[model samples]
Target: MLMYKVTKENGKTVYTPHFPPPLAALDGKTVELQGYMIPITSGFRHNTFMLSVLPIQQCMFCGQNGIPAMVEVILSDSKKEKMSERPVTIKGKTVLNRKERNRLEIWVTDAVIM
Candidate 1:
């Protein structure tokens, strides 16, 4: 779902997502993903964070290369793990953002570290 084609629309930048059938099919299903955890909060542990295909050292949401594949992960109420630059595996339900108003294209709800 992160696959996008950038174009100019009405003199503004637009990113159109291209979801393959296989990826689209995964929606609403529990999927396991492995990526680097990017914390949004400043605490030692986090329940909400972003998982990126690229390492935390790299810019996941900025740079000339454009936004990398990332998912806003909302960990389950029972799970709150410490932040780590190393890659982590999470299991959760995949949700695709169909609304253009949303800033991110994918999300992992009810996630838990595996």
Candidate 2:
């Protein structure tokens, strides 16, 4: 889950996303997660995509889930085999992108479908 705290710095108000200490500790570590892939592009063999805890119909963007339920996935092989609709297990190094307000909060780099 994510938490937010507002603070005034340099005479400007800033809103930041805060993860639980345990979740934040996972940053930069290799981890495995299971989810359904949501393609960011038009094809099935995508290097970059979104992994959702729920199916597309119940994704966070649809107002059915929270931000923690999705992650941005970047495959290690850009030309890897096309992904299936079924849930898949992926392994990669985790990245937390808290500063980017307009993007997915979590990212997995060098991901491989397992």
Candidate 3:
């Protein structure tokens, strides 16, 4: 789902993603993902964060991964999870950003740790 085609826009590099049919079909749908939590704020428990496909060692924040490797996560109302090194399984509605290359490519809203 992270696959993209690189191109030149205004003499600057731009990445335009082409989502596969199956992946595209998941937009606005609930899906489960297993990943390490990358907090948006410094804390032990969080309601919003980023879920990375890779562990912190090679996470997006470390510059070892790209936008596709992570998804912004917003937990369900009043729900929070403690940050941990172990992977977590989350079920949420998927939001795909197909037009914005400078922002997160995906977001999981109303997520819950399962």
Best by TM-score: 3
Best by lDDT: 3
Write model 1 residue lDDT over 66-96, tens digit each, in one string. 5567888999985788998889999999998
lDDT of 2 by residue, 4-110 (tens): 77898999987787889999999999999999988887865778888987777776667865743689999885745576678999999999988897777889999
Clashing residue pairs, backbone N/CA/C < 3 A, model 3? none
Model 3: per-residue lDDT, tens digit, 1-114?
Answer: 467889998999888877788888999999999988888789899998888878887875577757437888999996888899999999999998888756677889999999
Question: What's the lDDT for residue 7 in model 1?
Answer: 86
Candidate 3 has a TM-score of 0.79
Q: Which 10 consecutive residues of model 3 have the lowest summed lDDT?
A: 59-68
In model 1, what is the error at residue 19, expressed in angstroms?
A: 1.6
Report backbone clashes per prediction. 0, 0, 0
In model 1, pairs of residues that clash are none
